[model samples]
Target: MTQLPGSYESYWMESVAGADHRALAAGLEVDVAVVGGGIAGICTAWELTRAGHSVAVLEADRIAAGVTGYTTAKLSSQHGLIYAQLLKSLGAEGARLYARSQQQAVEYVAEVSVQLGIDCELERVPAYAYAESSDQVEQIQAEAEAAREAGLPASFVTETGLPYPIAGAVRIEDQAQFHPRKYLLALASDMVGRGGHIYERTRVVSLDEGKPCRLTTEGGATVTARDVVVATHYPVFDRAMLFSRLEPSRELVIAASIPGEHDPQGMYITQEQNTRSVRTAPYGTGQRLLIVTGEKFKPGIGDVSRRYEELAAWTRDRFPGASITHRWAAQDNTTTDRLPYVGRFHPGAKHVYVATGFGAWGMSNGVMSGRLITAHITGQELPWSKLYDPTRLHPLREAPSLLKLQASVAKHFVGDRLPASHADSIEDIAPGTGAVVRVEGRRCAVYRDEDGDVQAVSARCTHLGCIVHFNDAERAWECPCHGSRFATDGTVVQGPANRPLEPRRLPTGTEDSDR
Candidate 1:
């Protein structure tokens, strides 16, 4: 057996011992019900609780253990080369609003940490968007100018504190990085301390929006709230078909221990080589965790194991002598308009709201979404929320991306169902791995453990009826259409899909074989 490098868990998750909150036991009523215990949901709940509203947080899993825990945790507005694109699409004022919102989000973490006395390892540092190849220098320069115009403290420079030479870079000052799980776990504690209720393993199965939004849990418990915020990373409900406008991509992260002297000294990213983001966190005495992330791809569409290898190779080349200590992946949704949806769920929604599509900048965007949603619920909406209104559509800017996204989704929805796309026999599935196979004229997601036990589940995604593909590296079946992920036993791991993939019986004729 080939051994994988490092611990197969997030460093952020490993570094902290999070609090354990019980699952929802019975029906309850609160001023607000927040679905999801991630940074966004937790932040929103904390804000609402501080605003004198009774709030209950319902989490399908542990708090801060999802995308927020797996994040790179760079709290900066310096999304690689985003200002240039935003300038063209949303104009100068709109871009400034985004910059200001994100910048404020960075400080919000710092301010809140002090206010709550949470030791979250928050450190202010510069952030950079660099160009490696000569051909991309002009783009970096343009981004610098655009970012400056957008009211950020951005400037173009040739030298970044990187190990390698770069053609040019756009540097933004006053950015920060921290242990997101530490910060969010503290926020979760504060929420509970402030009389806000939190429930774990309480997956919201359905939402009925009205004067008092009614949310039903998988455990048969119910939560009634005057308002509800669906900050479940991806909104569980698609009443407005927001799923159609969102594109899901998964990126790999590898962290290694390096000498403190080798620290990058800043958060850095580039558009080259799929994408490369670099930062460091305090690891141990006189050592720092050199975290590198990149190799973005749509979930369930690529060889994820190979992508991890590529990321490792790239990291080793850039930072020699570094010993890899951890490896994990994060899934993010990008909106058609390249901004998050963080406001009223839809135009018609009176008491329901959603916050999603933070792209890869979840730490900053998640905080911003929380604050924005809090403002909306309290009836003091920020002007910047207009940029993220779920109902606001830019037909001219969004049509092309939206159409392309749906086209790919449509292909997977229809094409993966063909018999030719599935394994001909169970023998095609290797031990300790899985594959989609057609058995007894029915499509099934089958996994064969190293112990030789086989299990099968319906291959159709519970979210939109698209076929689910096995992610060998992560050991989860993932929906390519909308990023719904399921465990080997067919239980939901991530969502847009609240229901588990139904278990299926293997036919008598088809059996596992050694071929």
Candidate 2:
């Protein structure tokens, strides 16, 4: 087996320049305060600043270091066989509106990159959704038809640039791809140039909804703003039980260097059950990097190592000579109705807006979110605003999925409280792995770090008390209920859970076991 790179580092992170933003230190007032410094927050800040609004962005970490940095960075409206489902759940007009918004977002990114002279490796290419077997061909055909009806330039085709053969495919022309971090870095610079304040390592802990909204930081500093955008991949403030409504899934991504002669001409994704997304990025003057990503599962529910091995096997079988370069994983939220929530945080909360549940197509949706939220804040009307309104509901279409997700939450919430499946002593956990063990009758999360030290934390998720499972691949504690994740040392990594996992004291006898 090929040894994987150390701890989940994304290809974009290795290439992009870091932003030297300081943490929020004192109370301040701004026209708009945007939380989360990924693409959604940065784009929102850029748009608001462009409109002459004084915008302040408060990020728990550096800019573009979240989902944006980890994405496949395909800037396309061709979101894997979605139009057909949209045509069914939403009507034709709704589907068209979604298509229009996504296409406009793609164009907007291109326009911005060109206008800003950002060399983010932006390239225009066709996107394809293909089927490996005849059984899946009809879905591809239907998707092509639905896409065309929804204003996307799509057509049914059997021939593609992929190395593997396909039964059929839906090809969408003029789709684009780029290095998301580079693009966002340029935008962040422009936002600062326009008098926008962006603070890194500054986490917004609580929000007070009023005429002038107040956000309290983890450092005890306050930010008062007329409007606030909670663009933090998963909304941290769960005032309306947003966690229960959105289902979270984790997907693994791996990039490898391939022979220049075998570079694919377009981005492609499989339409079958085991979805595989494929795209190529320019590595050097004459070489290309092939990025293959898939293997999605409910967060904290699967064997992460096995999933990574499976993806690696799939890649080797297809491109035997490919050299593994980078590997990472990203978590995305999916709503019951298959559309994102990108408007007001909730009904009756006019000043607070949120954008989430983009599924796996956040490249375009993130940009659309920034544009949509900015429009609402600046008193400008957008046609597709109602479709993405967080308050909108389709009870009949959404009820089944919503109930299913809630049932899973209840099962894990109760199941995790019972007992540890394996009664192996905490010392049995090998180095570089983690497990839940009963410490003096209380379940605790125990991770044996690489340096042979044992790190323990309360297994209970700080969000809603759901028991968190150890993700061995990432060395993090992940909540099965609503996707809250924490590092082994008990710091919050992903949220909806703003508080870090509570540190636990190891039993006296367990301290020197590894020694």
Cα deviation in Å at residue 491, candidate 1? 0.5
lDDT of 2 at 301: 78
Task: Encode model 1's per-residue lDDT on 1-515: one tens digit a residue.
Answer: 24557899999999898888999989999999999999999999999999999999999999899888899999999998899999999899999999999999998899999999989899999999998999998899999999999999999999978899999999999999999998988888888889999999899999998778899999999899999999999889989799999999999999999999999899999989999999999988999999999999998875789889999999999999989999999999999988999998988999998999998999999899889999998989697978889999999999999999999999998888766946777877878899888877888999998877788999999998999998888899999999999999999999999999999998674554563
Candidates' TM-scores? 0.98, 0.98
lDDT of the candidates, in the order given: 0.91, 0.89
lDDT of 2 by residue, 1-515 (tens): 34675335788999777879999999999999999998889999999999999999999978899888889999999999999999988889999999999999999999999899999999999999999899888889999999999999999999988887889999999999999999999999999999999999998899999889999999999999999999999999989567878999888988888878898899999845467999999988677998988998888875888889889889888878888888999888999888999999988797999999999899999999999999999899999999998898888998999999999999998877775543368879888888888888888889887777888998888888988888877878899888989999889888888999888999786766978
Candidate 1 — which residues are off by over 4 angstroms?
Answer: 509-515
Off by over 4 Å in 2: 5-8, 421-423
**Model 1 vs. true fold: TM:** 0.98
